[model samples]
Target: MRIPLSDDNGHQYRDLNGNGVLDPYEDTRLSPEERTEDLLGRLSLAEKAGLMFQTVIEVGPDGDLVETAGRISKSPTSEVVTGKHLNHFNVHQIATARQAATWNNNLQELAETTPHGIPVTISTDPRHAFVDNAGVAFSAGPFSQWPEGLGLAALDDLDAVRRFADVARQEYVAVGIRAALHPQIDLATEPRWGRQAQTMGHDADRVSEFTAAYLEGFQGASLSSTSVACTTKHFPGGGPQKDGEDAHFPYGREQVYPGGMFDYHLKPFREAIARGTAAMMPYYGMPIDLTVGGEKIEEVGFGFSRQIVTGLLREELGYDGVVVTDWELVNDNHVGEQVLPARAWGVESLTPSQRLAKIIDAGCDQFGGEECTDLLVDLVENGEVSEARLDESVRRLLLVKFRLGLFDDPFVDVDAAERIVGRADFRRQGFEAQAESTTVLVNREATLPLASSIRVYSENVRPEQVSEWAQPVATPEQADVAVVRLLAPFEPRDDLFLEAWFHQGSLDFPPGLVHRLSRIAEHCPLVVVVTLDRPAILTPLVPFVSALVADYGSSDAAVLAALRGRIAPRGRLPIEIPRSMDAVRASRADVPGDTENPLFPVHFGLTI
Candidate 1:
């Protein structure tokens, strides 16, 4: 299907629908709303159904769309784009920026041959961070690596936040990712939650400020061709998961709010809406008897709750942006070797068609992590779902595509992509931020700012890497100062879909590790650094070390620079470090900093 060209006033216009004449949707001169209405009117029921489904996709080494070889859905990209009519995809695992750009161009070329010439909109989770969770976010890899979201919060500077987002926006655009499935605005209220590293912090006001800044940086003052549209999620907040488990598995499906702070969790989302975030995503965790505005809402996942999605987010808040449900809500998925059940928490008893209908009724526009457009088409044809309802969602989805300028030109400069991604200047900025984000928790007797000539024995720091500033010693007794790096403690679990990647459960260190650290401390002045994904209970181990530092995905070089005084440690605690597991169990899951005698309160940091 070749797009016809029309000549007018020395300019050319594309007949996107190959209709031989110019249609309103093909005219770049018209407003996005006008074009969306025209295109919505022209699309068939099947095409509209295709616009409603957004699922994960993979690109092969040759920059061609390929089937993913995992437990996740492996729909052929060609079939999904042509046969099924899906234009939205969440891409994963491309080798480099050049490869990603080539893949994106190939995908757009495929879409151009469609009857409507609807250019595909590719989205991705956060990919600029160091942590690599297959089920959540990807590693920096070939892109400039920055500190995690928690580290950004630790810096507590809006300008720095803006810079980070702008750099990320440029990188994403270079690789042809029009939509960012990130800027997770959920406040880190529960210290044990595994996803806290992706949040700003525990304070509502602070998180709200960062949320607005992030949207401004990614989408700019307003969305345009140069901007990467941001999806602020998980809507109404997803931080209060019961027992700190994620909602990806059946065991982690429940979200409890014992402190009656549901409204508090919604504050950042309210800010995100006001900032004009392009889209929103509801988490998979079902709220357990959550009450709002003196009325008790039903116990269901946010994606399936009419009161929460329609009554609260739509009616009360007046947000009209696209609401995409969190991944795999309608069908079970294979995550690693384990088979994870569909995260249809409240609607578990409903059939797949019934669940799809309920999600539409709940005011959601698109289904994330699902490729089953045929089911939606079947429902519309059978009168299970009205065509008008489908139009409502298609209209919103089309508006986003038009606003992103994807319908006009969706290609990228492959050579420029290689130049812009992980460039020297960008890498330098990321390293500086990583160093600035290193939080000094304790510095008794001014032990830090150690001389560069001191003999150093390191536990986790690579000897060759630390040799830049200090003499490397084999044992603690042979060194003047002993520096050690350890990850925050987590209870290991073997479950579905790379559950081990998540640092959940108890935060206490094992007795053997504690004894080893104490033994090293007795031999020399000990300096300890912990990479925090969650707030580890450090009261038992804090007594042994002379200096304590906290890092959120900083490189080894950045950590050494902070200790050597080449970089100042200015970061603060984004989430509270509880005194013990007992206090964490007693604290309210929805409340921040409610633990009794926490080891370190929110925003606690020290600087020499």
Candidate 2:
């Protein structure tokens, strides 16, 4: 076993390099800059290359590292941690909090056996929400579930945002997750964009306010042992998808700004940087022939554009934090039977090695969803990419690891993780938030706060949950009122690896579903609740319903409680519901609240 050296004040520090003497990086008292520089000096080419790659990893049921088959490349945890020297990972699925904590400890123990004894820094995408798209966000399994990011924005409460982040931070630190890969902060300028639910909203001011609150809650007043470092993402914003197609596919690669509102998208990111966000992730979309501040930018994806990543974000904005690219920028991804092309976008002509070199040249410190350290090492050894350049990124990566207190103690209390995750109080808060965030857009004739004794016919609501609030009847004709729940509409597509999770395409309801709802409305006083995953065209249904409620991933009981007036909904519309698809097509993607004759303006919510 390795022993620690004691200082004059009795504070012990681990001899990480096993050099038989205290090194600056091994000393806890030294400044992060000094420690980073010292660690950079001691690392080999292979070790530094490992620091540049941050890829996805899976945990087995018994707390052992396992490889996932198909699309997600599997690297054995032991080989990746010790042999490959990779210390950063984005954990995918885990059975339980205790198992996750045990798995983390196992990974850290393996790292201790390595030459430098570097503890792994585990990170995750947003996990405290209801959405569970593998490529986007994960569901709140074994954790408290809240509304999606847009749902939080709909509440328009800064304190609520802070509370959610704080609770998530506590749960994450307990499970040995040191970094958060989210709090997207991207404006939902394009209503049909698949990832809008992950954003704060379309308004720059509100997005800015929430961004600061989110960062503060995750990082605390300052980063410490208890804090989880936050990565404010899709940098410079990613809400301007052309034709509402995501940049994950070839057709959706272009991010257009037809309204000349490029700077508007950058507003929230500026606020995040001011609040001291630890890291930033550029999006996959390329700015197609757009000009910002009288200067024409290169028509390339943000990950490959030195002008945007280095010039705009690094130099112009004065941000010096770690810059990580979005997934699959270099190599093609295998999603079951389908293969996704590398999102090189404008640089599709370049080889894999050339793409990796371009990312380094763009001033990115780490590559997300990629594990090609060999290519990076080869580039450095061949003199194509200089050692000094590699050191710059490795230094930044080390600073985050050190700042996160990973070097001191990377393990967690497995028992504590079991006790802390999804605790009763956390669950209560989440449930309460769900009720509070249900937006009541139309409540004509004071129709809400339904009587408990009244007969009610419900559709899409669980029979047990409906029975809790009112008398449930089989037919709409036999009931005093009909309560129906509907999801926002989307055109489905067949694609590889979690692409189906993205609810993209037309927001208009299909004819059959529309007819069913219209027929239900004809029978009795109808109360309709629509979950707004994306802004839906509600012109047809709006006229038929007696009451209209909007939700973003709330539980059935929470919706019933809100309807019963047990908890009043304070949520407002985060995105405007367009009158028709024509208006949506005519409006510019980069501009917010531009829909012509919107059915309901943003911030439109009512309470009886």
Q: How accurate locally, in lDDT, is each candidate?
A: 0.88, 0.88
Clashing pairs in 1: 335-497
Candidate 2 per-residue lDDT, tens place, 491-558, comes to 88877555677888999999888788888878888999999888999888888888999999898999
Supply the TM-score for candidate 2.
0.97
Candidate 1, after superposition: displacement of residue 96 in Å?
1.1
lDDT, model 2? 0.88
For model 2, what is the error of residue 322's alpha carbon versus the real structure, in angstroms, after optimal superposition?
A: 0.3
